[model samples]
Target: MEYYFITGTSKGIGKALTEAILQNDNTYVYGISRNCAVKHARYHHLHFDLSDTTALRNNLHKVFVPLKEAERIVLVNNAGVLGKIDYIGSQATDNFEFVFDVNVIGPAILMNTFLSAYYSQQCPKIILNISSGAGKRPMDGWSAYCASKAALDMLSLTCQKEQELLGTGVKVYSLAPGVVDTAMQAHIREAESDQFSELERFKLLKENKELLDPEAVGKKILQLLKQPQQYSSVLMRVDEI
Candidate 1:
């Protein structure tokens, strides 16, 4: 049986993805969220804050210690923070630092920890990072968000290279899920009117129903995991799949 370790499963795309994956009869999902109360026969929910990186790392080690003995591992680093909207110069340093901690450093550390345990097992493994289009193209007021995603993209690419160097079967990719209807979008829409750009653009997009469904993205993720050979070394966008 294949096993998936996913984060941010409390809501939005993460929640949808977790449910979709658990539908498979041979699948087991370890979902990490700050507020995970949902119970299922095949799902294991663990509550922890991503802000505490060391604690998260330790907890993940504990979770995988037994699983590593039996099955293959797939790590999905999906939890991320979209910091307050502000221009580059006007943004607070704390916002940038916090974003990096959640988006970049946390995932990198998790990959390192998981790989250290999985290396000896020689199991087929993959790390999927939930990145954003902001990483590919800059947005005027999304300084922290854009930078954090950019860092995450690089981290995934670098990890893939390192895996190749070690001659390990593990593969990694950073994926952009596009604009989805999530609380994160609500936060962006409610940002200070003056600081946010193209409010009309967002409104028009919303009115035109341009947002992708979270479940659709979740299914695509499951497809990727099932047939990973199709996406081994590149950063994939949801639109492309």
Candidate 2:
């Protein structure tokens, strides 16, 4: 049986992926998020606020389990935040803290925990971090978000090298799922043009119905998993995959 652990499963790509993976009778999903939005016999939801590391660490037993008959184990870090969508100086310091806590620190802890829990397991293991293009390029008002994601990309690359040295065969990647129509996008749309220079561009994307759908993106991710080696870059875009 295949096992998948996903964060941010209450909505967006996380929720879509969980539901898509559950269509198979031989797969089980452990979803971690603030709320439980999925209901299925094989889908288990663990309520978590990613910023609360102490609580998550204490309750991690519910997330990972021994893999006796598992075909593969996958961890998808999909939860993230945009923080305050304003220029660097205009945003509160706490906003940066919150963004890093959720985007970098939380995922780092989870990846460490996952490796520890399944270090000796022979099943194929994969770590997919939901990254953003903003991480690769500077954006006008996404300082916190971009920095956090850039950190996450480096983390994933480092882990991949570590896994290689250990001969663990764990596949680690940070992927940019370009422009998806999610709650985050809606929040971005609400930002004033003065604060976010891309305000008009984003508005046009929404108006033109150009944003990728969560479900379609989820399916594309599953397809990518089937042949991860084809797109060998540690940091990749969905189109390249």
**Every model's TM-score:** 0.93, 0.97
Candidate 2 residue lDDT tens string, 76-142: 9999999889897888889989999999999999999999999888888999999999999998889
* Runs off by more than 4 Å, candidate 2: none
Give stretches of model 1 more than 4 Å off: 68-71
Q: Please, what is the whole-model Cα lDDT of each candidate in the order they appear?
A: 0.82, 0.91
Pairs that clash in candidate 1 = none
Write the residue-wise lDDT of candidate 1 on 1-241 in tens digits: 7788888988888888888988988788888878885468888888877778778766776656557444568999999888878877887778877888888887888788878866787668989999999998878788888888998899888888888898887889899998888888877777776787766677666778887788988998888877888775569887666
Per-candidate clashes come to 0, 0
Error of 1 at 77 (Å): 0.5
As for model 1, its CA RMSD to the true structure in angstroms is: 1.7
- Best by TM-score, which number? 2
lDDT for model 2:
0.91
